[model samples]
Target: MLETYRGTYFHPRTQFITIDKTGKVIESDNILFPLKKGDEISSINPFFEGLASYFDSKEDNDIKFTCVHLESKKKQQHTCDIEFKTFANGQPSLVIIHDFSDHYEYYQEVAQSRNESVINSQILELQNKYLKEKEDFKNTFIANFSHELRNPLTGVTAFCSVLQKTDMSLEQQDYVEVIKSSGDHLKNMIGDILEMSKIEVGKLTIDEELFDFHKLIEMLAFTYTVKAKQKNIEFEVDFDDKIPKYIEGDKTRIKQVFENLLENAFKFTTTGKVTFTIKENQRRARKVNLNISVKDTGIGIPSEKLDIIFNSFTQLDVTQKYSGTGLGLSIVKGLVELMDGKITVESEENVGSIFKMNINFKYPINQENTSLENKLDIEYKNSLSKEKYNILLAEDSELAQMAVLKILSQEGHFYLDIISNGEDVIESVIHNEYDLILMDIRMPGTHGDELTKMIRSLPVQNCKTIPILALTANLYDDDKKRYKKMGMNDIIEKPFDETTLLSKIYKHLK
Candidate 1:
């Protein structure tokens, strides 16, 4: 066979040899390894050295091994597969060798590809973990910073409220008003940044509840009317009577949307008017689509920048005159989208800008004879009168405690005890029968949630059922839900005004 195929492509790379039962080569083909007729079969390669012993012990008919032969002069190697076969008597007889370099190279490529894929997968997983950790750190920093900021601003605004009532000259009052307004602005800016962080982390959520749409609009109108008077710009609210008065939606977020739009309108318009209009777009059974627009005859945005105006921290005005953190419109857009709504804008550089939003809400099932209006009126009236009630305030911050005391002092309706730590708070709740408990979320000894749980588990009925309002500087939607689940009746964010603080107190007191 070697003579017939001597010069063919397969002949030079293939070798044949005859071996004895003792694994000694009796006849040889030197095409592959330059072996002689009397050479030992194991002398070809180290791999075959073990193969000869394995075949001798196992009584195998054929054994295959991949072995390498090196050329010392060329400094190169050739890979080959060697098959040793025995005759019918089970005596090892012949060895056939074939070049396996091509197969070996193919397998090496496959192994290298698999190794690269494994490494890439590990790297991707590590990258994802790093990003998640970074995101978590960012969120924690934002929450802590917000808490630090809101605490001090609460003192500023609360003192501003106190100063506004004191006897002062016209100039002094004006100066206090400026300080109050600036403080309020700073508070809103902080709120915007915190809100944007929440949005980025996917923590912001829409909480839907039954609310009076007309009352919400009425409150906005009353508030903005005063703001309009201060800005010397005419403000108008055009309400569509066809829209339902009672609707189900996230009232706070909805109010924020309108407030932000109106705020932007009033901020840019110096010499002209700002108008907020709500019109009914379409009405299905129990579902109403409303078109809301805020138009301002102020310095409008350029057409080029209209697209990016809703981007976070994007400001059209480069001048230092106008004041904002540039997160208002972005927050407004985020809120609108979160409520399953859409908003658009039309603006020119000089004429004016109009922001239009469309949103849907469900009319409450039982709207007739609703007591919302009556309840609000009674709460306001009760807040005004000095009704004797016992109130316990748990606050760790001295400034916050002073602010609350000063604000509550105006009504003089409640006998108030302030506790700064959780141990004292628990003791107070256990011993004292109070109408309301204002629990601070972060305090020494025990956190507010755990303290509330401990109080609820007490034997006293008042301890379990008393109106426990969570006083927190970091009140996110998740925290609100958690507080509610942990037996907090309501939540009052820090830096609260006298009216808000008292209204909540009165509402829960009833």
Candidate 2:
């Protein structure tokens, strides 16, 4: 390597070049400088610590050069800046030495960019997938909404027409009863809608208690027996008394679950009977597991459609022939799960369907069970109304007004008057005093909010802090809050049951 040095000797290990004003190399040395005589360097290299200063210096001015270094067997790699300059007469002169290694770093940067691009693409794909699923959920909700709304609207329309007919025979009166019964069914279905809304929006609170399991089954059987009889189908409850007598759970909601199931059974069955058989495991200090099976001889579901029947708004072909909101089983499933229970079904086409549900729960001791006691008293008294109370009814629809009036009349002891719109409501309030008002949010001319504000603005002496309840077809939370803020004492979602409406009236009016 030393022999490679000649006049104004140059070595490759050191990148520095000692040069004169004529652009001739006095001395140059570096190991990694691989430059030949005609090779051109474009820019400064990594080893140039003060590259800006080197490019600005008079000794290296008018030059473009990059650093190059070489690996050695023993000595460490040396780094030095290379420079190529022009003489004052414009002739190119060069002296080169080793500089910092480029070492494939540019390729590593390209690979990193590629990986980031792939990751970004995956994130975008996931975002699009989520958006599509959200849209699908929205579509499903709309379908269920239409089904729930249609049932009550259909009843309100049909019953009004039936009640308007004057010339009616005994059979015609029976038809009217059927229409009214269907309307009541619609109201019950709407109550289920409100219950589901409460559950979905986390507004429903569970009230747990202990009650006789056998008594609950017996009551469900007796109630559904009449419904089955109306359909000309027999109803039976097969249970073993050996099971626990008292179970600590929300018996009211549990019974409601089975009642909904049995109702569905009777509604779809026209010819055959519906049987409820209870089987249980009696072990572990009154710890009971009961399977309640309701087998119905009705228009059975197709095997493929059976799975989706419990889904909201889902109905098979046989169900579409009759009247239903298609929310019965949906509500049933929700209530069943709320009790930490499981429900399943089996059906064969035209052969009927069977639903089997299992519940595991504990029984309470030494406390008097009000469920059976209250149920008996409920059956003995006006089952719909437990108290006499004054109620003001405000609504726009004549048909709805008449239906509600008939229902209240059936309850036997409600001091109720119907007002057509909010304008009449104010006039009625000026002269009369009432315990509670059932104000329809949607009226012909006046909106409920304006009416509420007007009611709130009267003189303190004239003002009444009466409970004003809203009855509206809309069941959204925002709608409920809006009415509540506008001085509504509470809100009863539209198309409520005879029993539920009367109960609410009794509660607030009293």
Candidate 3:
């Protein structure tokens, strides 16, 4: 083959040898290492080494190799398929080299063109990913917004309706209470959402002031006691005397924290005891750390998912059957961090959960504050005075009517008449002398806005001027302005606080 091709050859196993077309072996042939020879075996062996290294690094085995030896070097260039054949016993037997240089050169030009196509494909993939995330975010935002708004709106609707429907069954009354409670919970959630947004944007400003922490705990325990009683669960609060009576912090925000923790504890514990323990640690001088804990005997979180509960939109239970925006813990974490505190939780499945948080701040002096009994008495007296005023309430939902009526009744107030639609509201107003009108915006007959405007147009002066407070689910500032323009005395967002409602009434009545 060496004489016919004008090239040198060598036996890989032994010495150099050349063969002719007559099958005569010429031994001691030129090894051809110094000069490049066409169809030389020595020149191609280096190409095999490069191809082996390239192929070994690739994840897939189906590949090709090509080599071009320039004509100036008087050498042959070739592309080849290097295949390792194995015997039946799985040992490599032979390597077959098949040349395909011309084909590889053609395909190499095609691959360069295909590079642009690959770049476009990657861009398209990224675009799709962003679009999917945007859609998901929109959906979550809508759901949260609707839930936050509807909860309070539903409460106002159901409570007003309950008062109108005189013949409610015992179960229906219980349903009314549940609706009110749910509305309250939703309102709190909305507040948390607003606070969370503020925190995320670094706009949540804290009002540092001196307040009684012991009184705060007592208030929390008292509020949760009623809820725990309904669930037939035992609730307890243990405070060490070493704990400061007063603390310098945002009292309202601190109360919110206590309420959230206690609420969470009571929510999960259907039958078992829930407890709050408070301790004062003066780890650093001039600043005392208030260590508080809430322990609940309920369905504890799974170990794996515990860490994620404090993350926004992460539900320890994704089913959402327990009623949450999954923002409760996230808000807690943010607030705790803002206060320069730390929070930790311990839980076991089916046993219970324990949450511990410490707030470090300057201690305020302990002083005599209004007793719980005195506050209740004053509230009761104020509510009793409100009972004399006839309230004309217009709402469409039976559930909302009931919830409001229950709240009013719970406050020991009785003078309120409920109507489901706005159609009869004018005539009702004309017939009865109302001290106040609790109006719902989205009613069946004539919507709240139109009704309020019509009532304002009536020449019957004093009754027309009677305070008309709007009860609505919409929390936008524009909605409040709209209600005011339509002759509403004030606006109360759905899931409004009972205390706030009464305060509005008192302000108008006085």
What TM-score against the true fold does each predicted structure earn?
0.78, 0.58, 0.48
Candidate with best lDDT:
1
Per-residue lDDT of candidate 1, residues 374-400 (tens digit) = 567355555554468889999898988
Off by over 4 Å in 2: 1-167, 171-216, 223-235, 242-252, 263-274, 282-288, 296-328, 345-354, 361-363, 367-391, 394-432, 441-465, 474-493, 496-510
Report how far off residue 413 is in candidate 2 (Å). 8.4
Residue 10 C-alpha lDDT in model 3: 32
What are the per-residue Cα lDDT tens digits for candidate 2 across 38-68?
2222212334343333332444244554434
Ranking by TM-score: 1, 2, 3
lDDT of 3 at 251: 85
Candidate 3 residues 368-425, lDDT tens each? 5622222443454455454367888898767667766776775555588999978989
Q: Candidate 3's C-alpha lDDT? A: 0.68
Q: Which parts of model 3 have CA positions greater than 4 angstroms off?
A: 1-144, 151-158, 161-175, 178-205, 223-234, 267-273, 283-286, 297-299, 317-325, 349-351, 362-491, 497-499, 508-510
What value does the lDDT take at residue 501 in candidate 1?
81
Order of quality (lDDT)? 1, 3, 2
